[model samples]
Target: MLLHASFPFLKEASYLASIYPQIYLDFGLRIPKPNFHGLMSSVKEILDLAPINEVMINSSGITFAE
Candidate 1:
C-alpha cells in the first residue's frame, strides 16, 4: 500500500510508514517545490520515523515546466 502525495501529511504518513511494513510513502510533486532547507527539513521529518527504503518518489509522469 502506498500513501500518495505524502508531502501534505509528512508526519502522519511517516508515522504510518514506520509502523506498517507494507506501507510506503510517495511524495508526488514534492521534488520541485522545496528549496534546500525545506527539502532537508521535509526529508528529516520523514526519516525521523519512516525508513529511507519505505519512502518513494514519483512524478506521476507529469512535469511542471516554467
Candidate 2:
C-alpha cells in the first residue's frame, strides 16, 4: 500500500514502512513546497525511521496554476 500525503504523519508513515515489507511511502510535492530548511528536515525525518529504498518520490506534474 502507498502512503499518500504522508508529510503530516511522517513518524507513523516511516515507522510502518520501515517495519512492513509491503508498505511503501509516496511523498508527492508536499516536501518541496516548504523552504530549504523545511525540505531538509522533512527528508531527514523520513529517513530517520524508514529505509531509503522503501520511500518513493512521486510527481504528477499537474498544478493548480492553470
Candidate 3:
C-alpha cells in the first residue's frame, strides 16, 4: 500500500506490513519533506519494525531542478 506523509502512522504501517506479506510501504512524500535528522529517524523507525524487503522507495513523481 502507498502511504503518504503521516508521521504518527509510521509505527502502525510498519507493524501491519510486517504481519501482512502483501502489504508494502512507500517512502514518498514523507522522506523529502522532513529535515535530515527527521528523515533518518523516520527510516530507522520503519526498519526497526518492518523487514527491508517490505519497503519500497517512491519518488512521488517529483523532479529536482539543477
lDDT of each: 0.74, 0.76, 0.76
Per-residue alpha-carbon lDDT of candidate 1 for residues 1-66, written as tens digits (9 for 90 to 100): 554536567898888998889888886544544578887777778789988888877766676677
- Model 3: what TM-score? 0.76
Residue pairs of candidate 2 with colliding backbone atoms: none
What tens-digit string does per-residue lDDT give for candidate 2 at 8-43? 888889999989998888876555455878867787
Q: Which ten residues in a row have the lowest lDDT in candidate 2?
A: 27-36
Error of 1 at 30 (Å): 2.6
Model 2: how large is the Cα RMSD against the reference? 2.5
In model 2, the runs with Cα more than 4 Å from the true position are 62-66
In model 1, which residue pairs have backbone atoms overlapping below 3 Å?
none
lDDT assessment of candidate 3: 0.76
Q: Which rank order by TM-score, best down to worst?
A: 2, 3, 1
